[model samples]
Target chain A: MMLDNTWFVEKSYFEKFAMAWKVRKKLHSEQSKFQKIEVLQTESVGKLLLLDGKTMVSEIDEFVYHEVMAHIPYMVARKCEKVLIIGGGDGGVVREFVKHKDIKQIDLVEIDERVIEVSKEFFPECTQGLDDPRVNILAEDGIAFIKSKTNEYDVIIIDSTDPEDFASGLFTSEFYKNVSNALTEEGIMMNQTENPFLDEWGVGKIYKNMRAQFPHVQSFTAPMLIYPGVFWTFGFSSKKYQGTQLNPDKIRHMQSLERSLKWYNTEWHKGAFALSNFHKKKIGL
Target chain B: MMLDNTWFVEKSYFEKFAMAWKVRKKLHSEQSKFQKIEVLQTESVGKLLLLDGKTMVSEIDEFVYHEVMAHIPYMVARKCEKVLIIGGGDGGVVREFVKHKDIKQIDLVEIDERVIEVSKEFFPECTQGLDDPRVNILAEDGIAFIKSKTNEYDVIIIDSTDPEDFASGLFTSEFYKNVSNALTEEGIMMNQTENPFLDEWGVGKIYKNMRAQFPHVQSFTAPMLIYPGVFWTFGFSSKKYQGTQLNPDKIRHMQSLERSLKWYNTEWHKGAFALSNFHKKKIGL
Candidate 1:
């Protein structure tokens, strides 16, 4: 970390609040083309990944964020043979997708190859799916890559970083249009929006941009430990899905994966859509 | 705060993680008859109430916690006219209860009178309900107070602090039996159980204790900002009523106070019970 101390502190959302993890060991530190990447072994959250001082994933919350991101939209859709992941170099999303044997082709387009490399070394569990024969790891700019595709992916997971600088294009109107065109008619796209409490404006902008292109745009929330607000949200914009619908077939599908999942479940999938009045009021949902 | 610094830090749950709030100003600080009480004007959370170095209530999250605490049981129960609140010195619970005109009487028993007095001076919004003609404030020990009453209150709200030192008794089996006996035949009680993520042992103990006493012991969670894990939970133990059950009258009751509440709603109430698989496994629910 940039700080020369035992604590790795995060000051995001205009320094409104700060959360510190006691540094047990600094696993890796480097400057990637996108941002500063650092992997730290912490006292509490175990292995912590930081991109430009913002917490991206940890050993503690990785299962929760990744499971919710990958499984929620996958279960909602009727088909999931092909998948495209953008900006998830950490491979957590890929690992979740790998759990389901039905997925035939997997494409992970991460702008920073260094993130994937680091994850393979420091966070190998998340990167195990990268070696699967059905998977394709494309180290390229996600924004440019999506514009060249059409009606391809059954499920597209935009595991983008914070909507800042280079990654900011991920939440733009032009990008949403490309994503809409990139997906099949029954496609569902889930993006890690941001903290519901801190990033209301950013989240709202993403929602607005997605709403213009997609017919169904909804949000689901889950509490994440490393996140600034803890109450984190994921934006679901699809061509034909309200999501969280109770289907007996999907219940069996969820039940089959029960022993593997630590976070996502059929009951939770339905429950995650429950947003408080203030949550809606803040993000203009 | 004990620390002579700009940040008010909380190191709870064996300091597995730490949350720090920047102090704009120290509004009040003192050692009460029980524990240390401090009220601070914070940069992010605004006015915050801290009891014995633990974050209690903040302007940003008070509505979320207090609303969930008060309204969930109130709407679930067949009757909520007579209520007893144990250890809610800040009056946040009372404030929520006061919104329901159907509630005829409320008795608030707090161990520390200073928390109430300090909140009255610094956090007037939370304490405004204390002035209601039907509300009564008693600066006495709740553990002893509940033992004296039998079948008196229709609902009991245990807004006690962490199960530490003097407040620890609030989560004990004996105390729970006393509380169950103190309530009417068809009564409900809600306690501010600690963070489900951080306090698995502590939370499980309370659940086991409550389960032994009440036939129905369910839990509901909300994202509280100042708390350790931020993913906070409350224990719902009732003689009857599988809460969050859809009732038109209760929905109307929740909707009537929609303008007054920032967090609680009928939809969110049912959703709040949606615990992640990891969350259920962690707390052994």
Candidate 2:
């Protein structure tokens, strides 16, 4: 977030694109052991959460990020009884996970504790689901947490920040292999891939690494209004379920619960997988 | 544009968002009766054009905007002999129109002559098609020009600026009626509607007005990196054909041409029309 109190600008040095929001004031600020977390109330976007000077989530448009990350993998996987979400301290991912009726358990592992406190204080719409009885919020390093488990989660959603600085290890090949080992044989895993325009090479490299470990790997995009380019991508890797194949029965059920979603739908789910020629060549689809 | 020499920031005061680019240097600046025009050579975006302090286009991601705006209507419309483009002074619309072998004539009506000159100097990639023998460049008000014509063109694309200030009249019900009359019985029209997040009521009003004039109306979205929100929408109004149908044979032929289009394809063409529930409800789709 920008240091200035009235305005918050998230400038991407490498990408050379900046996004700024008009803020009312800083609501909270705390420097945790892992990262610095701050919440700002904005004029239009509502409360904004910043980690290490990077805008993580806002009360407005958080649904785009949370819905895309959680719904894509959760909807595709057949048996989504057990789910693991890593690095979603704001609880937006958990908010989406609770929408699924069949999901019996959810574990959210966030390294930074301050983000949770900020979310609870500011972004209640996103953090409200953390109070669900089925959810288990664990404050731990996701890499180490995933490494200890095998055949555990039916679906894993990494709602982490960009793969740089404190979160660089999450995109490494070793972490992907560990994630693969932790998931059930038919489990699906999705990581929040960076913008293709800004980090084409990085996304390609991460997709390559995930492909090396998983049988089926693909990338999908969603509108992230606050991100550098506004369009953010996600990498999907599955051991059994192909991301493109959608079950009609599951879609019918999801259609009945359409009120829970804002951005994603069954048609959009199929359309999101349809990458452009440029993106298709980049990820070698 | 931001006054800073090394960086140019496009901030939308109404939307409460800003996009900044690191620039090498300023190339040119001119003030016309319509608006202020400036050209800047950027580090990554190549040549950037700003009209009235609003980003018009950049060399790097112009394809995403131009391709989606031009190809969506061009590919869907069966006959493409004659076309009318209103207010695309940069020539990006004409550039994409000439790609079709069937398109014999294109009439480009741009109010500001300075924008055309700037495009010729800095954005030749978008202006090369302006010199085609079949293309006619008219320096006049698009509203008055369209008002005089009837059953004139197979496709009419409104590539104007946002519906504000001088261009506000273009989004009215009477203007849409004029556009409907200017088109052939089976003609199609596509307007560069603004981002929904920024102009939800404006887009909804335009969509409602267009629906009253045309039999079939639809809205599609595309990522415009420099816009207020990354997701920009386009309004499609056709007299005959449904917007969702795609011709497989034409797609095959277009693919055989092998042009290096950065951000459009047959699959994406279809995918672009798949609206999210939020947008669908907003536009009354």
Candidate 3:
């Protein structure tokens, strides 16, 4: 955010587009083991987080990303109990997972512990779930953390930063194979793929890699106001269940929690799976 | 767009957020009677149009806005023959309307003549419809022009800028009554409402204004990649047609046109009308 000419801008350097907010003040700045991290207080958009100068999450619109990442797949799956979240150190996804009454365990494997410490201090709301007994935060490389698991998690979420950084290995064929091996037979996994229009990291590449390892692979989209392409997409790979099909009873049951949400709902869920022709073509669906 | 040290940015001044593009060069800049007009050659995004420093359209993603503005309403209406567009100086919406074989007379009333001239020279693809015999280009104050018509057009579209400056009158209650009188009994009018998330212009106010005049008022959303709040929303107000109901025959027919278009499809159309909980709360729906 720009205050007295002090502005924070995240440039999609190669793509030539950037998102900037007027800075009220700089909350924190430091170098993590894996990346550079900074939190700024914006004039309007609440607290903002940047890792390696890339937009990771902001307080105001973070719900859209975290809710779609955790709630959509959870509601679509037949059952979810043991869940693995890779690289969501900010605790936003962990917060959403804590809302699910059925989930008993949540393992968050983040490569950087500094991100978690900073998040707990600056964005307290997102970090509230970290205090819950269900959560287990692991400060380890996600690429290395998923190696030993076999048919373990009921749901797996990859909330990595842009693939150009340390998280590049998370969007590979071998990573998908390891994730596939780590899920139960009817498990579901979702990776935070990039925007549909200007996804420089390639949402199609994630779709292809996940499809090679999973029986049911669907790419759904949502509007993420701060992402490079506000028209953001997620790669959903499942062993069983169609992401498009919303069971009537399940939808009715989901409505009870509507009062608690800012964006996701039964209607939004249906719309999320209706892929645009642009997406269908990219995935060869 | 930044070339060397030159970067073009649009700041939502009150909102404290902005979009910037790395510039290859500034093609043209002039002050029109209405607003500051500019055509910038961006490094990545092809041609960029700016009105008073606000992004109006970009070459690469203009189709999403134009197609959604024209196609969704055309397909939803029981029948559309005569059409009217207000303030769409770029001619993108007119080009989409011209594609409908069912549409006959097309009247576009853009207040700024320079925008048309700049678009014709810099962005010809958006202005091709100006060559069609069915399309009429009328440079006038659309608010005043609509006041003279009554029950004349089958479809009316308001491709307006943000509801500030001179366009503030366009969002007033009086304009809604004038538009209601200008439409045939079953006519549909869609306006380019702001983004779903960072809707600094107030989509709910437009919904309330149109709901007072029209029987069926629906707010549908699409992702305009170049637009602020890329999760853009459109206010669809009609005397009868429900924008959400996809008539099977219309769906079958819309599928035929899918191959020719880039984004709009039967499924995407269905998804467009699903209001998010945030939108619902904002609109008091």
- Segments in model 1 whose C-alpha atoms lie over 4 Å from true places: A1-4, A246-248, B1-4, B246-248
Best by lDDT: 1
Alpha carbon lDDT at A216, candidate 1: 89
TM-score of candidate 2's A chain against the true A chain: 0.94
Error of 1 at B267 (Å): 0.9
Per-prediction DockQ scores?
A: 0.55, 0.55, 0.57
Docking category for candidate 2?
medium
Off by over 4 Å in 3: A1-5, A13-15, A247-252, B1-5, B13-15, B247-249
In model 1, pairs of residues that clash are none
lDDT of each residue in B1-285, candidate 2, tens digit only: 122445687767464666788888889998988899999888767788999888889887788878877787777887778999999999998988888888899999999988999899999989999999989999999999998899988999999888788788888889999999999998999998788776544678889989999999988887777767878888889999877775454787678653577777877888777778878877766
Pairs that clash in candidate 3: A1-A21, A1-A22, A1-A23, A2-A22, A2-A23, B1-B21, B1-B22, B1-B23, B2-B22, B2-B23
Q: After superposition, how far is residue B260 of candidate 3 from its true place, in Å?
A: 1.0
Summarize candidate 2's per-residue lDDT along A192-274 as a digit string, tens digits: 87877776447778888888899999887777776678777888899998787875558878887766678888888887787
The lDDT-based order of candidates, best leading, equals 1, 3, 2
